[model samples]
Target: MPKGIYNVPEAYNEPVLSYAPGTKEREQVAAAFKEMYNSTVDVPMYIGSEEIRTGKTRDINPPFDHKKSVGKYHEGDVSHVEKAIKSALDARTKWAALSWEHRASIFLKAAELIAGPYRAKINAATMIGQAKTVHQAEIDAACEFIDFLRFNVEFMTQIYAEQPVSSDGIWNRMEYRPLEGFIYAITPFNFTAIAGNLPASPAMMGNVVVWKPSASQMLSANVIMEVFKLAGLPDGVINMVQGNAAEISDTIFDHTDFAGVHYTGSTAVFNGIWGKIGQNINKYKTYPRIVGETGGKDFVLAHPSSIPAQVATALSRGAFEYQGQKCSAASRAYIPKSIWPEVKELLVKAVKSMKMGSTEDMSNFVSAVIHEGSFDKLASYIDAAKKASDAEIVVGGGYDKSKGWFIEPTVIETSNPKYDTMCTELFGPVLTVHVYDDTKWEETLKLVDETSPYALTGAIFSQDRYAIEQATKALENCAGNFYINDKPTGAVVGQQPFGGARASGTNDKAGSVLNLLRWVSPRTIKETFVPPTDYRYPFLG
Candidate 1:
């Protein structure tokens, strides 16, 4: 295994696997390093600061493997679950009593810590652990997460400053309050930023959080806990327990103190948890808040006047980044037949030029999918596409598993909208392109709507004002977030709210004040200058 640069032990003298700056060899080096680490390392790494099973001190694997890592949490028999809830309940009374400013200060300190000494190591670990390219890892571990922290603090500031007013002699005041019980954060593996938002948002609002991170990205999650600790957050304020899905769900759902669940995963899991919450509704002191962001079959509509180069760049990045594992990743595109040739040519060139390999290779723009399961699923989609009469692979459709779960960036062209490739969510580095005649613009819009049950995100590329306007209005309900002349994947922290309705889980958009609202409950407090001296007034008379 390559020696980790940021937190290498003094006695560790192995040569570090250095990537050639800006060269594709960097991706090769990254893949090589990951392969070595996964195959050679024998110990299971803990996802939290303290090992739950052994209750011993241990150094974390610098570049942990996602697949081989096991859950550090032991099955808490019924008694342990009771103790966890009691701990949270005991902590909440004091945590909720603290001023909002005091709570926000800890998040500010966390942002500072992430940007300072912890930045490099965290970024490196994310790259190795998640198979994210160095640039992608930096964005996930540093830029996006820091932006979320800053945005959350700013949001709390605004919420605190705004005052309620009354016109007459009466006075009314309203303020947001944290749920008096524990908040559970069930996060995904695609983005580390999402992991931070799940718990941190509620934590900033003075709620105790029991975070259950995705099993695939536990190391990245642990690094987040380290940052939170360095920020001086009270230990019990944020507690992390790592376990498998069944174990986690059982523990979280059965625990009476689990007041709220913020989730991002498959729709099935979301619905299952919702059912559990409903079944156990009366067991809790209050109703639990359930917020989720599920699957999305995001689309991109290419008008005839759309610039080929720009649209190609947008589509390529949106479809292939993180191997299209993100919920918002572009999976389908609607192109007018009038400009089909130009669009196809540009897309083919773009996909062909993309360097795909290990993330450590600086020149490689695309990295491996997270694991073998994703690899198999992506391959199945490609095989299914190969048999389609109207569909053709425009770029890549091959996979190699010797070193890592690497698949070639692929593009498929199909004239039939009914093709399964165009209709289903292929969450991988595969794009399905559908062509429609200009006369069928309205029909194509309808097809896009019918094809996706998810209304998460959709984009339009058009230079004409009327075309952009028409498409925007028509597809408005097609996505929670709509974009023009931009990719759907790069939704900013403060600017864009990032969730959708219908099958795409709840519309509790992350990264905005709306999401923060779901984590809290508003309370009304009224104070009078003097007590009412007379029980009877003019109205009573």
Candidate 2:
């Protein structure tokens, strides 16, 4: 341990780069995307110091250009998962024993590497791999990821500095230790930032991680591992495995050394993992920590006093950005009858004008959904809405998977608030709006709250302070992160620590100290300056 205490640099959100048509970032990212798209890179499982390339491989194709191949990733089996767990446990001793500052420094270096050298490449990788537009990629893959690292380092320092209040004769201190054994990180395909964070956060807190990135996100996930290696992250500290989710999860869940899991994915998968852990509760050396941010049927409720344009813009951006794949994306909306006409007109025009195609086209606001399954799901929902008596496709409802898994930014106007499209989480560019009576604001609030099982994110559009206050109070538990005038989709790192409760997640706000605290097991130490010969305390005497 170092003699002197150290302070980490102040953490700030990484500035989002706007890849304007004439900008240098635009040109650079486009070039990088072109090169990466044309090239064929092979990704292998990273276990300990070795790169294990299983013969079984899956080709990576961009969702927008499904026929074109960008790369291929090797598939690992159950044995590989076992190897990954073993490697993590083996590395945990040395990794967890290292000075906290050194651990902090590594991730800090990763943030800088991402911010400076690898910004465009990572953005390009996310764009190609996950079908994100340049702006979305810039925010999620580049800025938000950098922010998670830097902010997490700062949060770690804060956690360590939180010492116990010492008494006069006794010196008290607190030690934030990593969880015993190893951490399993299951990351999603939507955000490369989340893919990096789900593993990196635990590791930063001195835990070893066995990471399983989403199969569809392998292209960017590969780049993340490369960045970690370049930043001098030890090999076994974060072992990457790719294979069947069930096989890998079962192997991890059964391990005696399985310490915890940091996950971001479907609620069903999380529930299954939770159940598996419960069934194998007695097999673990320690009780495993379960941290996850799952599915969301996020909402947008408009008050009668709200501006139509503002509400329209909020719905357009909040619901349609990134093809509405975000857990916090506005999937359902409750609009008052007063502003429904104007809001409908503005929203329709906006959705109609949104250009949809490849991420390569900077002007295009919308891109393909992540994969064919997601595309099919969205298509089926659209088809269902078209046929349903309670719902009608308002403006954009066309979907074509011929050249790409492209779905037009769609809006569904529903007569019934309880309609399937309004209640269900259609994780696509589909926003279902239900117009309610202007006088029944409180009733609508109740309806919004009770509509969905998720409470991830929601937004309330109201110029009236009283209505805003009422909505805030009445719809409190409906959303973990609630927006007053803005869209609920973009939750910045430090500014708005994101996560939700209910079926959505544990509500452990990521991008804050709250999330970091989950990874550590704190111990309080109290030492007396002088030892007493008597065994009994003064009170006992």
lDDT of each: 0.74, 0.93
Candidate 1 is scored at a TM of 0.87
Question: Model 1, 482-526: lDDT tens per residue?
Answer: 999998887777777688998898898788788888877888888
Residue-level lDDT of model 2, residues 1-541, one tens digit each, is: 3387888899988988878768989999999999999899999999999999998999999999999999899999999999898888889889999998889889999999999889989999999999999999999999999999999999998888888788789999889999999999999999999999999999999999999999999999999999999999987999999999899999989989899999999999999999999999999999999999999999999998899999999999999999999999999999999889999999999988899999999899999998999989999999999999989999888999999999999999998999998878788999999999988988898999998999999999888899899889998998999999999899999999999999998999989999999999989888999978878888986
Q: Say which candidate scores most in lDDT.
A: 2
Candidate 2's displacement at residue 45, Å, is 0.6
Evaluate model 1: give its lDDT.
0.74
User: What ranges in model 1 sit over 4 Å off?
Assistant: 1-51, 54-83, 167-171, 539-541
> Per-candidate TM vs. native?
0.87, 0.99
Name every residue pair that clashes in candidate 2. none
